[model samples]
Target: MAPKDPLLGTLKVCVLNLQSDGEMVTDTNPHLASCCELLELVLRKGLQQPVISLVHRDYWQCFEQLTHQDPCGRLSALSLAVEQTRVCRKLLSAQGRGRYLLRLALSRKALPQFITHLLHTPRVLEWYSPTTSILRNEEFVEPFMSLLLVLSHMEFKLNMENCSFLDESWLLPVCETYEVVPCREVGMALRYLSGRVFVLNLKPGSQAYVDKFICPW
Candidate 1:
């Protein structure tokens, strides 16, 4: 069982400080210890787990406190939260699964935050949710879907949802641009693609839109 009050007070202090001070937490600080500790607790058990909310409350506290900081440190904590949310879905699925809407809601809520954080550090996109299929390994369907949402919200003109399911026939098209052979990863790729469901051409020479995800490839 999880600790009943695992690191709760510590997190609160951090959050409060963040809200009030904001700038002080950016560089190495005494509070970073607390921050790291809280992250450890959340990572081990998960964010939806009671301990996680406690950590989250504190994380927000710290975020409010550290407005002057570079925001880099906070990215790890946020990423962990996103991962934890994803884990909940895995657990739900393992228990013989139910409707995807519940999973979608939880999954859907976490992406925007993660996307915003990564936007500050463009390279972070490669590590957290990469667009290049050739460089990306493993099935990171939710984060990638979330990425599509961010791009859509940004009005990038690509339909991530539509392009997500690039048909085997479409695979030929995807390959011509990306230099990647998607055939090997069909099933996993399709899972990520399912959200968009189909594709459309925006207009002549405007770029192809699939599931509303606009991609150069």
Candidate 2:
């Protein structure tokens, strides 16, 4: 077919390294650990750069390729890389950096996919800290809310329950603070909790304004 993408090749190598080890990349597996470190560096750099450049070049292509090749395995590696890099924690820690990364990820159509892949996978979500407070942060509210809403839509499309990303404890607080509407396309009825109804819009980008609030009563 076409020449192999270098980035994709690198990702495959990392994936293979992890597979060959047959265990988590621990200190014992120096080679696998090094590969993971390199992968993290590449991902962090890609996140910092412009979406257009990241996608039009090779990062997105590599990601997509790895995803298609081994959806579960590659995603595991990615989730581990993100965790090791602490990229999300760092971004959420700073208003400016969080906003910048959120905007950049959204602009490139990467955030939704990343969030879905990161949170939807059973293995990954098990250990994921669904930090609800991040949703309340001023800088993160819009992007985080939007991505959650998007995830709701994807689940609806798959005939799955809405808000699959959040557990009951996290969902209640978020729904209380923010209006989470389900996607209309699924014909899913509004879920009511204690007389409070939650609705989601079908349109992908049609999330309620971050500052807007509705009385739950």
Error of 2 at 163 (Å): 32
Superposed on all Cα atoms, model 2 deviates from the true structure by an RMSD in Å of 20.4
- Using TM-score as the measure, which candidate wins? 2
TM-score per candidate = 0.21, 0.24
Deviation in angstroms for 164 in model 2? Answer: 33
lDDT of each: 0.32, 0.36
Clashing pairs in 2: 181-199, 181-200, 182-199, 182-200
**RMSD per model, one decimal:** 20.3, 20.4
TM-score of predicted model 2? Answer: 0.24
* Stretches > 4 Å off in candidate 1: 1-4, 46-112, 115-217
lDDT of 1 by residue, 12-98 (tens): 555455445444232233443343344334322221223344332212322222233345556554545434433343222311111
